[model samples]
Target: MKLLKVMLSAFIFYLSFIYGASAMAQDLSQQNKQLLANFANEVFVKKDLTNLQEYLHDDYIQHNPIVPQGLSGFKQFFADWFKAVPDWQYRLEKIVAEGDTVWAYGVYSGTQQGDWLGIPSTGKHYSIHAVDIFRIENGKLAEHWDVIDTYGLFKQLGVIQ
Candidate 1:
């Protein structure tokens, strides 16, 4: 009957729309995963900031208490740490990306030769674990959060008993 054919057509269109949306979401997630990996490598491993604008938004927001908000703040924070820990580097244990958020688990290692967190140089090496969360927007990092083992780092630095 005409009614049965019309109903079938509508159902098919609905199914196609749902499938298309799901496929698009999956593609975005995959792209986000790659973006985070590249950003981490360029920023943390390579310690290069010349191309930071390609990975981070100008109005990026930071949830970490120690670091201020915005891209300039991020660059300054890294500049200070890079000076304090000349050999600083991060080794990622795992990374997960879904929707517009990415989660990274990694260990940071370096030797302190300059002041950090107002603590004088200890001339000692330290390795600390941390988890970073990022929100991606328009192919750039828009917001960030982190949970670091500051206590362990301080203890290793001989700043705590």
Candidate 2:
């Protein structure tokens, strides 16, 4: 009777452990999705990198279509881009996440206020669509892949002509 009771207790504990692990995994996935949404709506649109630093790993790598960069490199790149497009804002269209990966689709619009990529500012408003895929690990962004409408931006800025 003692052995049977002990075995029964062990089985119950094993089931509880499995359920707890599953719940933890689900919670992590939900947290990652929420983090991505906040990143798009708050950080990217508002250009508020201060708060974003918490979620971004120090070794973050960006695979931008035009230029690849690490975390510090992206910081400088955004700084320069914002300098050129002072009124720049991003609107999130869609966001999806699974496991440790999140994908965001958005549109960036702004008026040229300073030089960018050697193109003189024309003070003209431009809109470009963009997409970013991010990988998060241990609750921090580890890497990113980005695509932007570079041709449209250049055309609007009169740099492609």
Best by lDDT: 1
Write down the lDDT of every candidate, Cα atoms only: 0.94, 0.83
- lDDT, candidate 2, 44-155, per-residue tens: 7778777657778777887764444666766777778888888999889987777888888899999999988677778989999988899998878899987888899888
Model 2 residue 59 CA deviation in Å: 1.2
Please give me the total number of clashing residue pairs in predicted model 1: 0
lDDT string for model 1 (1-161, tens) is 99999999999999999999999999998899899899889989999988889999999999998997899999999989999999998998898988999999999999999998799999999999999999999999999999999999999999997
Give the top-scoring candidate (TM-score). 1
